[model samples]
Target: MTEPRTFTLRDDLKLALELADAADAISRARFTALDLVVTTKPDRTPVTDADQAVERAIRTVLAEQRPGDGILGEEFGTAGSTSRQWIIDPIDGTAGFMRGIPIWATLIALAVDGVPVVGVVSAPALGKRWWASAGAGAWSSDERTPNASPTRLAVSGVDTLAEASISYGSLQQWDQAGHLDEIVSLSRQVWRTRAYGDMWSYMLLAEGHLDMAGEFDLQPYDMAALAPIVQEAGGVFTSIDGKPGPWHGSALATNGLLHDATLAVLNPA
Candidate 1:
């Protein structure tokens, strides 16, 4: 019997980067031409259109390139096999994108049997892209400096909450989750706190600019692309309760040294 062919981490990472490129092309154009004059009542038309368009573009490419792989996308939901799936959030911060904020990004991740092994986050509006695969260190590049080499990312060395800088996505989310008191308590212990919000906070944590980040009410599409990058950058990515993987409905990312301490604070009996 012949053995099944296997793909390398680098190969998957390259495909993920290509997927991000296609996604950025569609998302950036829509965001640039967004009609801010239209009703601002959180109408889903613009973002929903962009989201579906980007996902379709990515799915087309994947269908041709990796016919055997499964896909889980925000706009389209799940398809194909669950063993080796691609999780996608065509635009990670739709509200920000719709509002002409440049913090939105396309998130792509490859999960084999539910564990993400590769991740790519492309924020074209911000002129930045970050990516990683297992064993390969997390890295980022700036379109503003086209010729510059990609920089390897690393989380900070801060080991204590008292010295760490942290970000939580929103006070309202915490309050709604009934964890507002814990968040407030954590902020008091941290050296600094900000509600940078969305995927940017976790990206900042991976880049070592922030020591920790956590949030409630997240989906796998919102977090799968981030887990590998944070993990490869020498950080910890888990639920606020400390369970591994993006299956949990919430997230807590920190410099590895502070994960346990932060989890304790958020989950005290």
Candidate 2:
């Protein structure tokens, strides 16, 4: 197998777009097949299928195009090296999806020596895909607008917590993590709040439509794809405790201006 090309960010960005196409195919199909009739709580089969299928598709492509590269997937586990690993989460908001909500998507990212350098979020049901490569601008496409160029994205300038809008992934996640009060406190201090519960929240922030995004109990795949997009869009991406990377098990993403203030509020004594 040939070594993976250490392409420029432009090439990486193009690959991210191709990966989004593959992910959308598997994800949208399963999403459409889901019954979405929350009888009791929610089901996981639809997400499991979508997740595995999407990861398999990505793996197949990487094997052919970047043979020496590694992969870490939510459904398939790890394979190959970590030097140029591809991380994937084929379906990020299974619960919302199972309940007939449109907040789910597939997250694809390339982490070089554990630092995510390229990221893509494809939510077909929502008709949007967002992506970014290190040093490249963040971008998004709307399937609703056929053939239109993807718009460059940027974070908002709401500098104060009182003026910022925020979305934490899930109330249940915070409650389970014993940080519900901290989350609630932060929400009250912020101008707006919503548990958009997945990729949608972060994408909204990257588009300058929201000011803050944070969550707990996340894996690397959940946060990796988000980091580059948020960073490229002029936002800060870090752990809730103010750590600078996605390995910290929690996340706090905000337009660069409001990051520190949001960190102060999210940190529990």
TM-score between candidate 1 and the true structure: 0.94
Candidate 1 on 1-269: residue-level lDDT in tens? 97655778888999999999899888878885745333222424344577778999999999988888999998778999748999999988888887788999999999998999999999999999999999999999999999999999999999898999999999999999999999999999999999898889999999999999999989999999999999999999999999999999999999999998999899998
State TM-scores per candidate.
Answer: 0.94, 0.91
Tens digits of per-residue lDDT for model 2, 162-199: 99889998888889988888888988898889877788
Error of 1 at 166 (Å): 0.5
Off by over 4 Å in 1: 1-5, 34-46
Best model number under lDDT: 1
- Steric clashes per prediction: 0, 0
lDDT of 2 at 179: 83
Candidate 2 displacement at residue 174 in angstroms: 1.8
